[model samples]
Target chain A: MPTVHATIIARGGGSTFHRKNTCRVLGTPIIAYAIQTCQQAGFIDHVFVWSEDEEIRSIARSLGAHALERPHSMVHYYSGFATQEEWAAQRGRQIEVIAGGPGDVNVAFNCNNFLLRPETLAAMHCQAREDEAVGGVIAVAAVEPGLCLKTRDGSLFPFWNDLSVPRAEHPPLYRRTGVAVTFRERFRNGRMALAPFVVSREEAFDLQHAEELPLAEFYLRKRLGLLDSDRPAAGEGC
Target chain B: MRVTASIIVLERDARDGVRWDARMGGMRLLEHAVARLKGLPLVDELAVLTDCDALCDALGNTLACAGVPVRRLCPTCTTERFDYLTCEESRIRQQLLALEQAGLAGDVHCFGSWRLPLLSTRSWERMYHALLEDRIAARIVPLTTEDPNLYTPLGGDVASGRLFGVWAHPGRDRQEAPQLYRPAEACVAHLGRIRYPQPLTKGVEIAMTEAVTVRTAEDMPLAHFLWARQQAGRACHDSQDGGAGVP
Candidate 1:
């Protein structure tokens, strides 16, 4: 059987939402959700949390996940001048260094995307492992049509010529989410043939802004059955 | 910079079945559009571009009564074999030429009568200033929404049905995704730099509520509701300021 490894990348110093990964959601740290989900996933052989922050690493260790200390150089690999291929090459090298060696199958999860269920992760892993043609499987959500683009001379033009047509008849647009499963060889190749695993818009929500924290909590509470009207008030714990 | 505001009222089969003269908020939709443009201090001249003769006469009488200096222009180009967009483009070119010949210079801001009812004068002012500051040929208003979904273009390979390029990985701290900006129905263009078949560029972003364009009769109620809501908010704001009177 191929070894399925899950890596939850939680870096510190986010300008948008400070210490977002360590921030509590329904009493537990947000990063704990991804760690716990990976631990619960039967298909995943090992779970790792890659971060440079000592506090985040400590939390990962407490959550029964191996804490991989990320290098400073790896953390600052982003460059506006670098091409996509160059960035991918850099990413491949970084992953290889963190994982010790390129494993059989690698599943990546963003700590901010707390809504990702274990079942979804397992399914993605299975799909990536089973399909030879697929380089990787990533979550994507459908985008609505009837958008317009502005011309340089400031005239409005429709993305879809006819807004009168039924939505079903219009061409579909998909948005890529921050969750992916990749094979060892595909990860190193730089060029990946990604297959889209359709997920609901709610499932793909990433906790970025401080304003979104309440919404994320609401969804998490709803998922935990804490929001159920019939549930006993005293028994409620998420 | 001298600015000429053109209120474009095209005579075509409106998919929403709403005509330019349709009643909206106790006034004709065209009248609301005209009134909005007339209030803009930056605009040096005003012109109405339409195909209908009766509309010109009716609007002429109204403008004459109000003592506003206005120019009425009719497109001499034959509409035969021309689609809606092509026909509209032709009419705009004709109107711009007329304005140029009549000694009008600088930027020509075109306002579609359909969109003017909802857009605020503040938005127009911002667009004009942006145009001047940016030194760009035109300035457009982008429709804003809270939907956080970032999109990717579909690959041409129909058989595989795979997404084209490598996307932002989950490992990255700041995931960058391609943003699609939908244009709201308003734009300012410089007469000197005007080019046919203009390429798309970035525009000023506005709130989704403020970007509502009334396409059909069904959209009328929503427009009315929004307009009333805006008025109510303004009145409340005035009351809070101890009734300082309108600005």
Candidate 2:
């Protein structure tokens, strides 16, 4: 009976550097999508957006998420295992103020991520619920079987696999998506207890460059009805 | 507007001995259709009218779990494979009867189940808006394909975009002979009821400018390749995000 809570890390520069979580594609701000996906996940008890910018925090709050001003020092730090652990602790403290207790499951969800499906969040929650002993689960993409390792001497051979013999014989392989991680409070070392939640390559896409905006808009429009809001804009031209 | 999206599944079985319900991208074609439709935000309810036991068996649990209302518009009718146009006429007629029986009215979007594996969410959205925009003048907007493979067997005009019906009268529905050519992601919208054998009277048409249909065995490879390329491109983007405000 552990409460599931989520914290979205969304402090980015702006459209100026392509770091701004507010940098919008298809009319909706990028961070808004973070809030949206969290809502879709269904199991979250609380959704919080961590940011330093007043505008970004405003947007997050407007989109129905709790906003916390992030420390300037933590802004530029690349988040992975260490950041995830720290964020979980911060989340525990935040939840304590409201409910006077910490959730059993804490999710450190990163921004610039639009591809994670709601089912993914539900799956992570199910994992924690199924095994009280389970520590954490990180989103990963499964590489379609048939891969190999090559030596510096230019040798190519399957790595602990006989997949080359027949394509059907190979099993699935996973690679970290670096998007979202849900974990139990006590065991915060996500990398150690990393239960992989497999995502497709589409779900692995993370925005980094301004040039990728048009492309991201294209795909987002396909996935989300991003352009539905722009029907009026399109009507003007028609 | 509440959209009554009718998902039509034609009957298929092991009796055909043709894994016509072929597996692609790790799912049976019917399964992909059911899964993708579950994501559409515009659809208040999905009306799945099919006599095909396979579609029902494959989708029954998933649809039920999703909590979407489903109707099995019964008396599962079969179409003659030899007469393409006649089969299409029957196909649409079946959809119309199914919607009517389900007691669904107001803004209807109907498309073939086979088209499900290929059509993107954006296409469905466009189809929705197109219907709303033309509800004033047009009675039904037939979702037409563009040039390069409009269902020509049905006498779809390669010049403009006229299929068998909907412009004049479905029996001979075309405003002008050799209408504008268009087809794929085939669909039609109605304000309330779809009256066939009558001149379309007044209806605006929207053309989906992409090819995402699985009509024959030859189309499978192309559809599979296109889907694969799309996925590969999605997984290839990397974030070089360099900002302190991680919002």
Candidate 3:
């Protein structure tokens, strides 16, 4: 079986950004969750956090995540796919040399969201075990009714109630949940992302804005009994 | 005649159907759990009971397709339409009475409609063993949790939690049946040795009644209580053997 390693591209920006994002998740940094989930998954072999910010490095290490000192040139916001490829090559080679053999087939995924049905991991493992050409398995969420597409003036329109489509012409709807993305050894080139399989929006959460924070809080408290209900009386510290 | 295990689900109304959510929206959070349990080799027989014909048919059909024989009982409606609390008390009472007269050796598991949290088949088996060890006659095993407000500590306030029950060592005679709501103390005293090999004294009855009342008030499911009883039995056995069971 191919060794599966998790590569976490932790964005290190302003302290305020980190604080704000972390507070949204009830004192849990956005990146911390990604790392925590990777640790929790049974199939993941190794986890590497790539970030240039010293604070991010400290936080990542404090959380028991393996931190890689990312190259400063690759830190530009607009660098995009170029940075990923640059980092992937260097990191992949380093890992390969360290092990005195071929590097891991890295399966990169976002650390933002929590898993609703964790059993999906078994499917991924099965795909890997059964098929060799499956570069990686990505989680996809089934399309909700409203998110359907429309073809008018060649522009994609979001479908809502009352819109009717023929059964034979029905579209197979799937949303790409950036929550989990996997890449095989041959595709571990960091400068680019492997063509990801689309996952459903229900299975993914992109906590980009402040309003999305409450959902994260609910996810943590419900899925994981992290918050102590009997903590100090409210309105004191928080 | 050898008897096998059976599952009895007490669903009062469609609102309390097996799919109803106690914690969050959506069908039984553990709806897929039955399949998960069937995958296990240890469990033998499984059954479900409900008031709604549709739900009963769906569950019965699903289990039947999977090659598991399940019995579904559509309780007769009382004055109110889908009034579960009343209809359930009436209908389930009959089933309980019938099972009591049969003198079967197998176990009976009763899960309430509001009980949404699902337990693994292995967990169910573990609970059965636990119940057998505890020698508990009746209690609820919460499949799903409810607002903690629905529960109370004996004298405490009530919350909307789920409940399950298991009956052990049933009686052969149904003529001297006791009322359902009879105080635990009274039931324990009058029907003490009737279910067990040895009769419990009035004092023991009161203590056991108090314990059951408190535990039930907290919404501990019948299966877990049975497990606790088993633990208590083990402890008693150890103490009798001169082990350091007393702490």
Candidate 4:
């Protein structure tokens, strides 16, 4: 079996919420959940926290995971100069630096998504391994379909022909969950034939706002069986 | 500036053969919309645009009951039936032309939809003020905050099943992501400044609660619930103030 590594991308500074990776959700740092999931997965050989912040790295080390100091250049700040393809190439470079071997597989996990399950990670790895032609397998969540539109020059324009049609008849939509498994070789080459691994919307919830933290805590407490019929005491599980 | 507020009713607003007459909190959705617009002091004139004669009669009754003067606008189109998705812009243009012909076209035009019963008077004022600012042709209300990172197109690559053209922000921080504004239910515009194809636009951010737009039968309950909650909140505040009520 090839070496499978899980890298938790926990950047210290967030534009919306500061130090979100280290932000507490049900008494545990958000990054800890991703690390714990990776550690619990049977197929993953190593779990590493890649971050630019010392506090986040220290937290990762305390949680029994390897801490990698990510360079500032790899920490992407949107300048509008680089296209998305260029950003992908830069990500490929970052992956190559972390997992150098040809056969080694790197699983990228966003630390903010605390609800990811070990089974889901293992399933994605197994799918990627079973399909040799595929470069990676990414987690996607279904989006509620409706009448989508775009605005141009202060005017609304519909993407579809008939707005009178029922919303249920619209085609289904899915979005990337920022979780994936990529082989080292596939990262080196620009062309990656990626496969889709469907996940529940709860598992794909990425914490970006302060209001969402309490909701995430609610879900986490529910998962841990700490929640009762009545409202649980504040910091009960913590 | 002369300001004209138009309550736009389209055939597409019908759900289960019911038009904007759908009731919420014991009042028709159209009534709630008209009452809200009627309360705005910035509005110099009020109008209703629709092709349905029955809807026009209903609007006349609604306005008469409210004791507000309104110009009923019936925009004549070349096509017998206008498909909203395909001809929304043309319909709006025709409405504006009708307003112009009636000499009721104000320097500033505010368009309200009957579907948006919860859009607050404060939000309308925000857009109106934003439009009044120099060089702004249009002002629209946007959702409080929406992360662009989560969106993906409908389909993916045929062979690999990988989502193509997915734009993910490089940074984990959402602020690093591009700011995108999805317009809410109402729009305010300076009629003179608007150009043919494109116009300079500004955005006024409103709370997510104020952005409820009822599009389907399923949405009516949520709108009604929200309306009830607002009324309850207002009542509680009024009693707390010794029944003096909001100024």
DockQ for candidate 4, please give it: 0.15
lDDT of 1 by residue, B1-247 (tens): 5677766655652434888777766777767667766778878876665555666677657765765433544345324211122224554576456556534545555444545576777767766666566654343444553333434446433234475433233434333533345556566665555544552233666654466567677556545655555565666788898773321
Of models 1 and 4, which has the larger lDDT? 4
- Which of the two, 1 or 4, has more DockQ? 4
Clashing pairs in model 4?
Answer: none
TM-score of chain B of each: 0.72, 0.62, 0.38, 0.80
Cα lDDT tens digits for candidate 2, A133-153: 446665655333322233343
Error of 4 at B95 (Å): 2.9
Summarize candidate 1's per-residue lDDT along A53-148 as a digit string, tens digits: 998889889988878776555454464556545644655566566555555887888776778888887787777777767788888776656565
lDDT scores in order: 0.62, 0.51, 0.39, 0.65
Q: Looking at model 4 chain A, which ten-residue stretch has the lowest summed lDDT?
A: A229-238
Query: Retained native contacts per candidate, as fractions?
Result: 0.25, 0.00, 0.00, 0.20
For model 3, the local distance difference test gives 0.39
State every prediction's TM-score relative to the real structure.
Answer: 0.52, 0.41, 0.40, 0.62
Model 1: fraction of the reference interface contacts it also forms: 0.25
Error of 2 at B53 (Å): 40
Give the winner by TM-score: 1 or 3: 1
Q: Positional deviation of A98 in candidate 3, in angstroms?
A: 5.4
Rank by TM-score, highest first. Answer: 4, 1, 2, 3
Native A-B contacts reproduced, model 4:
0.20
Candidate 1 chain A, run of 10 with poorest lDDT: A229-238
Q: Write the per-residue lDDT of candidate 3 for residues B1-247, one digit (tens) a residue.
A: 1223333344432232223222111223223334434444544444443444554566567667766555544333222222111113444355444334323123433232223222333444543443344443332221210011011112211111111111111222221222111111011111121233322111111111112211111232322232233345546679789774311
